[model samples]
Target: MGIRSVMLPAAIAATLCAGGVARAEGLTVGFSQIGSESGWRAAETTVTRQEAKKNGDTVKIADAQQKQENQIKAIRSFIAQGVDGIFLAPVVATGWTQVLTEAKDAKIPVILLDRDIDPADKALYLTAVTSDSVHEGQVAGDWLVKAVGSKPCNVVEIEGTVGASVAANRKKGFDDAVAKDPNIKIIRSETGDFTRSQGKQVMESFIKSVGGKNICAVYAHNDDMMIGAIQAMKEAGLKPGQDILTVSVDSVPDMFKAMMAHEANATVELTPDMAGPAFQALNAYKKSGTVPPKWIETKSTLHTSQDSDLQQIYDEKKNLGY
Candidate 1:
């Protein structure tokens, strides 16, 4: 196996100190990541490792490559190895009952990071550390509504992977928000699988079908998709931020850079430090037998180029594995 290097800031070194954790050091946890599907995913993986190393804990990782079966296998392997705990970034929202049950039977706690599974049983995992994906979509939609107030703006949306809870909720949130404004309508929608190339390809097809001039703005499920859509629009001789509005999620460093360049309008921030809270909960549980809540909801804030320190933020986060 080869090593992928990443640089975490000094402040993140103490990330696991939250919730009055009882210093549960040297615990070995297994992480089943959903592959490096996007820049934010890679950054989340890096931050997970960085936080674990800070507290002298060990992390054994399995790259699921965006497949639920692989993640199931990884969880079973972690259980067999008697790891202290497991961290799961589920590829999809369902098909987790048997594997999660196995982990529970083995008396190993599992923490979900960056996403949630279906709420078939809340006892399946200790807690979910994720942002409100639905709200993220709403944030984008609200921003676009305010940007083009009361105009007959036709929106073309690029969705994430099918069956993923984030995708479903984001789509619903955006659609619900825009439904309030009769003038802002979604003319076209399709899955981009949360990848840049696929986003660009989908945007190209949307442009050809709907005509870029008639389309008013673009809303992508994530910023990686937005970046690709921006490229596609430029290739078609459409000025993206100016001629057609842009909004998406994930305040990654690249998105901030684009905002500075005035190519992308707005993004919702999805922090990659999910492991920090997960580790804290595990530490508190192991040392004091306290059960963490079923869901640890993270914040989803909006960002735009109008911010005073966009460039500084871009420079700071450039090496965070994004």
Candidate 2:
């Protein structure tokens, strides 16, 4: 069978159990989420949970609270429980080999959702479902360059978790774009851990140290941090979008609201609806005992005030439980 048409092994388990005696429609699946740190993350959880129900599958979810050890423990527990399959949105890429190997040895296929691992190894996961993170960063960078024009701007980067795929790729894309323009200087950069609270705290330091007057722009890896940074700027008596331009990824409804309110300048959309396609793939695999592509790339877009599709997309996402 072609890889593109392959399916997850759990879907196969759903069938071939005579009279549904061995495996019921309530096939238990394990999901380890990256915690409810952002709107995008919340939407992902809502959609995945709803999809599992719609497909008559029972999902056991573990919220990692942004801790790698917690996620590993959850995955191991799922393995002990002998779940049909397991899915994890890894907190960071490295240090996952051992746990993944345990899952593999337990005969429970693993799926990577909405994040990626560095030093890619095929043995760790059957497939990964996520967006082109680097592309998102490049889009954000391109927009900033055009908006800033030929002006020499000092930038402060608010990175995500230290080693997450989104953080690494987004920063890489931003750096690549900034490199083309020698006038764009990154005066400060630090990991915000993809949390709103952390974003605010880190931006506080930047504001106190740089005085916000000399800073040209703030680039955040995700919208949550951007919002937090905006709050910090407000507290410092500095206007966010006006005094210092702001750019971020994840076009969540909150970000859109921020853009409409003029707190955020622009955002790149990273939709949170992987459930439908994931379920479809599972169905195909269960019926055919085949595998799907090693990686499935989702669509993304740039959201600016000039775009008419914002309200419609935002409305749709809100309905999807974002």
Which candidate number maximizes lDDT? 1
lDDT of 2 by residue, 1-322 (tens): 6653466554554453332345576666789998997666888999888889888987789999999999999998887677777888888878898889999898777878888776346877777788988888888888889889999999999999997767999999988888788888899999999889999999999998887898999999998889899999999998888889999998778777777777778898787876556566656665676787878777768887666676776676776555
RMSD of 2: 8.4
Give the lowest summed-lDDT range of ten residues in model 1: 1-10
Best by TM-score: 1
What is candidate 1's CA lDDT for residue 10?
A: 30
Q: Can you write out model 1's per-residue Cα lDDT over 1-322, one digit (the tens) per residue?
A: 1232233433333343331144355888899999997777888888888999997898889999988899999998777667788999988889899899999998999999987789578898999998888888888888888989977999999999998878998999899898999999899999999889999999999999999899899999988888999999999999888888899988988889888888888888888889999999998898899999888988788888788889887886787788
Candidate 1 Cα outliers beyond 4 Å, as residue runs:
1-26, 64-82, 91-102, 118-121, 161-165, 191-193, 201-211
Model 1's alpha-carbon lDDT is 0.87
